[model samples]
Target: MTQRLLSFGLGYSARALARRLLAQGWTIHGTTRDAEKAEALAREGVQPLLWGQDDIEPILAQSTHILISAGPDEAGDPVLNAHGALIREHAVRLRWAGYLSTTGVYGDHAGGWVDEETPLAPSTRRGQLRQEAEAAWQAVPGLPLHIFRLAGIYGPGRGPFAKVRRGTARRIIKPGQVFSRIHVEDIAQVLAASIAQPDPGAVYNLCDDDPAPPEEVIAYAAELLGLPVPPAVDFDAAEMTPMARSFYAESKRVRNDRIKRDLGVALVYPDYRAGLDALAQDEAGE
Candidate 1:
């Protein structure tokens, strides 16, 4: 049987996974809200359907696997709000379903380590919504659901190098603040592994081995670019958008043992250094 994936949101992480699945001959149908992005997805060989405007039921009916990357808002999960009933109706036919969640569901851990078993105690509204969304997805009966709680995701186009090179990078110093992160490629591998080995109702944390302070990552990115490390500003003194400031409200090191042990996956970039090194090389080549 040919594997068919219906991706609810073909964003960065889903697009990365789509690249791998498409190369393996999987029929991919993805949804986007923008006309430009739909065209881009089409160029990449994805059957793009505009959310809310296009008919997705037929595509949903035929999909063997589904990936939900659209996040929840104050109103709640957009996909579920729009198609929860339809997905549940087609649940029996789904071989595997994945939900891209965030480690934010674990909330503030005070720079401590947190595994999948950690209780959900989200400290922010964003985290709370994600936690609720996870529960909502779990409520879908008969869906072979798997949740991947991702940490800060970074890769080629989404790295600190750009800021560091532009001289706009600032090391926001929050005494003990540290965060876990995962490479986009690693995220794709983990998703692929879960597809290969279907484990219903499984939850995994996706992150690199190292969880370092925000300043360290900026400093390293500067070092890689042969530029001076940006000056450090105390968290309280830093000028930042509310969204950027919200990220510092929590500090936790997410564990990725389940993805490695259960999926038999190995991260290509286990730390910021390795991920940054590859990104710098790719930038140089381009």
Candidate 2:
């Protein structure tokens, strides 16, 4: 029997995962807030189910692979608050379940390295929320769960190139600050590899090999896009939204060795330079 896939919150991550699964011959059901996206999903041959507080039960019943990439508002998610118990009601039949989490859960490592077994000490509210959600799902008996701790997600048209093109690219510098990242394509590949061989109760840290200063990524992106890199801004001087500044506050390099060793996966975009270059070529109709 073909395994069924269902995703909550049809964000880029969910959609990317769903698209790959669909292409691999999985029966997929996906959720979207807007009517337009629902139509788009339908056009892509997914079962587009309009979602609300009460719409997931039927969706859960038929799905063997469940991906919860939706935010709490748009996808009835975080599962802890809304659907953990509800999902538990159908856990018996689930082959795999994955929750998209953040490396922010590791908090400020002061440029240290972290792995799957690192104790989670999330400094941000986002991290706390993710840990809470992870715990909630883990509490359910017989629930098949895997947690993916994603670094900053970047893909074509979604990275520093946008700011560089707009002349808003600030080569912001905070000496000693470093961050990790993953391209959406690589993210899809990791998830696809996982789905091919499900591993429950496993936690994976998904990031590329590069862990560099923010300025380096911005400059490389600008160069790739054939734009001038913006003047460097001191972290203290540049105005930053709390959300943006919160990013600089944490510094850690995440390891992807586990996924590679266990899943037999190799990164298609191993660094920002590679990812941006691919996007640039794609933009040029190559």
* Top TM-score hit: 1
Please give, for residues 1-286, the per-residue lDDT of candidate 2 as tens digits. 8888888777887778878887878898887778888999889878887766337887788788888786433232455456667777888789988888888888899999999888999998777777777776677788788889899998865887777887877988899999999999889888888878888898888899998898998888777767787899999998999999989889998988998999988999988788888888888895
Question: How many clashing pairs in candidate 2?
Answer: 0
Residue pairs in candidate 1 whose N, alpha carbon or C atoms collide under 3 angstroms:
none
What TM-score would every model get versus the actual structure?
0.99, 0.94
lDDT of each: 0.95, 0.83
RMSD score of candidate 2 (Å): 2.1
Per-residue lDDT of model 1, residues 104-164, tens digit only: 9998989999999999999999999999999999999999999999999999789898899
Give residue 229's error in model 1 in angstroms. Answer: 0.7
Error of 1 at 253 (Å): 1.3
The Cα RMSD in angstroms, rounded to one decimal, for candidate 1 relative to the true structure is 0.6
Model 2 has an lDDT value of: 0.83
